[model samples]
Target: MPSFVSRIVPVYLRIARANRPFISTEGARRHIRERTLRPQPYGPPRRLRADVAVTVDHDRGWPIYTLTPRTGQPHGNVVYAHGGGWVNEIQPQHWALAAEIAVRAGTTVTVPIYPLIPFGSADVVIPAFADLVLANRIQYGEVCLAGDSAGGQIALSTAVVLRDEHQVTLPRTILISPALDLSLSNPEIPVVLPTDPWLGHDGGLVLGEHWRGPLPISDPRVSPLFAEMANLGPLTLFCGTRDILWPDARLLVDKARGAGVEVDFHEATDLVHVYPLTPTSEGRAAQAEMIAQLKTALETVRR
Candidate 1:
């Protein structure tokens, strides 16, 4: 059960129709059109926390942001990918979380503002991300990949690509409400979507078409949910029962466990999608757990 603070989110989203862009084909098209016509600024927030230092660089044209704690040397590396259905820019909330991870966990957090759909898709971004993760690993000795929604899909796919192509696997991965299958073909989704305040299959399919590019909807490149899960490192996954993507998370947990992957799964009985990223009390608790997980994982890397 969700607390009053967290449970109120659904009411707000439902009243505001925040799911409009993700629930209808026309709504998605109009939203994307408006964004293309009038682009919003992307990257680190203008007024970032003073305790963290930010450096920006480019990797094959993708903007990579490295955030370090101003206090002292960081312990490990975290590459955070922000989710936007593959077209949305990084949100202020993402920057806040990255900074928190950098400071509280005492690790360098790298946020890659990968190209959106119609500009670049999984094919170009995943390999590039693998290279970035590799670069960070060489410098820091270990790297953790993390993301939410489409970004979570990319982060997981990058790990898979690293394993298949480079014969290397990341040490850890954190996926928050990951959009597992772009195909949106899960029969379970229809049942869950009705109660989901902020997502719909029709709009998701449209965004999926743009995000998959040259690959099929089920391709592992764009949808890692279909990929093999063997030989990967431990995973920290969070999901809520109210989201359409919740069903896929359950399937992933089963597949990953079957493949002998170590999974630390967190499920919210009444919360909505990405509830961990919100400003509610449950979100703060989830963030604290994330920091703890990063600290424990990074401490091992240091040793």
Candidate 2:
């Protein structure tokens, strides 16, 4: 059974309708303008934990945040991307997860603040991020890639670009409720659409078009669901039945496994989108598992 928090999240989202902006093109445009014009420390995320030290840097003119634990020197490195349907900025929840990974997994986490849609798109973001990952791997000797939702798409796309274009193989990539196919064409999407309190198919396509830029909806650069999967590192995926992206997550598993790429998928039966970030039992467990995976990679890096 879903925990109480799990059950109430959808109700809260319905009430907040924070995701309502993505329900239509006009709302998305307006939301983008509001965020871009009046940027603050965060859009609508919770306060970050004080256990870690966070510093901001820049790479190729994009802002990068590095979280290092107060406990000691970090043993490994993680490069994270934030997801907000390709339009939203990094939230405090994203920072919380990055800090958690940094402290618990005994690693330093670097999160790149990529440009959102109308200002940035896949054509410019992917290669630049891939280069940053490559530079991180060179600096740390080993690193992990992680993200949620659209950020997940960017992380996986970075890994793909690293493999096919840069000839680098990552050890692991963590994906949470990733938007594998921006086209929102999966038949299963509408089936879950009603259950999904936050995402709307119509608004998704509009944002997809903007983020996709000149690429077709099916292009591997924009929709990693169509990317070649061989020779990449292991993959870990998380999704819930309440998210419209669930079908694409399932599709990614099948495709990745068919290509002989190792995949670990955690399907949250009764949870909502990006449940791992919420303060729920299921979310905590999912995060615990993610930390353990990062620890494993960190261990390997130490050897």
Candidate 3:
């Protein structure tokens, strides 16, 4: 049986769907304009445990946040990209997760604040972020690429660009509830749409168009679901059956495996989108597993 929290997810998802218009382009534009005048959304940053030091810097003019634990001996590095459906900016929850990963993994984490849609598009953002990750690779040797939702798309796209265009190879890539196919036209999507109350197919499709800029929706940089999967890296993905993106996640996994790429996928039955970020038992467990995977990946890089 699903947990009690799991049972009520659809109710909240429905409520969120009803309130979705508030996050549309018009809404997001207004929110972005007024966001500066308003107080910080994540509240004042509290102190992080484990003596981890957090600093903000810039890479090629983009904001880059660096988290390093006091150990001063990181096993490996992780380059993280945050997800907000290609339009929404990073939230307080994302900051909290960065801190947690820094403390637990005791590794250096570099989070590049890539531009959101309306402000920038895949053509502009992907290369800039690929530069940041490439810098990490040069400085830290092999590094892991990680992200959630749209961030997941960016992370995977960056790796692809590095591999194909720059002849760079990543050790691994991890995606959580990634919007692999921005078109959201998968036949299975409509079958699962009613169950996904948090994400509207119509709104997401619009945002995807805005992100695509002059490129076609099927461009590998915009929709990695269509990208060549071989030689990318070992892939790890997490998604819930309740998420509208679930079908695409499964599709990508199947395609990657068929191409002879090693993939570790965890699909939680009936769970909502980005369950690992939630405050539920399953979410916490998933997070723990991710951390463990990070440690193992980093350790392998050392050997």
Candidate 4:
């Protein structure tokens, strides 16, 4: 039942093995130590190669890059958090995706180079993100939050924090293969662990523990699934059945529906984690749905 692009299956499997060691407790410790030692530079902005309006400013306590198309006025704005499992640096895929979203959806997309774990935890990262989102919301008027994997967690959590503590509201949230439950202690996870070619069950839990810092792993701040699902924003969630986090995605869907929130849930059988970010047919379809969601949020704000 797990259907993925045949050609990429082997590549994904190799990635899984390469990442498997970090699934252990010791692996997490060692990775944090190593990552801290070799702090990665942001390199050149990917948008520089394209014909888009790009600017970087540290007005929000840290550098935030904004990308806009040169053709037309943007419909709305999006603040995307890049995923790195809370420890890794932002990949080129993230930069390319941000640019694509800007061009396809006809919206300016702002990506913040947020700090990762050990260097940044719930206490430090979330507040800075909240400020960034709030500032964007005020500027853009109707901002939609979006991210993949760990970035997805931050996107969701930042929205919740602004709503609860800062009294700011967002239009919607888009999460692709989000690690909603940091504990990764779900009962049904073992069922998919073997079939999941890109994620390890134990490694995810170890990373989650380290990422949560002083907060309990199950705390709503770290695990948005455990948080009240009522009013974060309109939700559009995408996950693959083969992803280890699919079960948690399902649970979050149930909770959101129970809270009378509108949700557009898209689950593809046998797709890999963050399939929407991939350059396959299924991935394109998923990206189209996300663009539609962003457009819809723009309409809602316009009304």
Using lDDT as the measure, the top candidate is 1
User: lDDT of candidate 4 vs native?
Assistant: 0.81
Using lDDT as the yardstick, the better of models 1 and 2 is 1
- TM, every model: 0.97, 0.95, 0.91, 0.92
After TM-score superposition, the amount by which residue 209's alpha carbon in candidate 3 deviates from its true location, in angstroms, is 0.7
In candidate 1, which residue ranges exceed 4 Å CA deviation? none
Worst 10 residues of 3 by lDDT: 35-44
**How do these models rank on lDDT, best leading?**
1, 2, 4, 3
lDDT of each: 0.89, 0.87, 0.79, 0.81
Deviation (Å) of 163 in candidate 4:
2.0
Tens-digit lDDT string for candidate 1 (1-303): 688888789999999998888988998888788777776678688798999999998745877889999997898799999987887889999999999999999999999888886676887888889999888888887888889988889989998998999998777899999988998888999999889998889999988888888888888888898999998788999999999999999999999999999999999898898888988989999889988998888888778
Best to worst by TM-score, what's the order?
Answer: 1, 2, 4, 3
Clashes in candidate 4: how many? Answer: 3
Error in Å for residue 205 of model 3: 0.9
Report the C-alpha lDDT of model 4 over 59-103, residue by residue, as the tens digit: 766678898988877877899988878988877778877887888
Give candidate 4 regions above 4 Å deviation.
1-7, 44-49
**Clashes by residue pair, model 3:** none
Candidate 2 on 1-303: residue-level lDDT in tens?
Answer: 899889999999999995677678788777777877876464223357778888877646977878889887677689998988887778778888888899999888998888887889998998998888888877876889999999999999889898998898888899999988888889988899888888888778888989898878887779999999988899999999999999999999999999999999999887899999988999999999999998897788688
**Please, what are the lDDT tens digits per residue for candidate 3 over residues 60-169?**
67678888888657767888888877766777667677777776876788877776666779999988878787787778767888899889999898888988999887
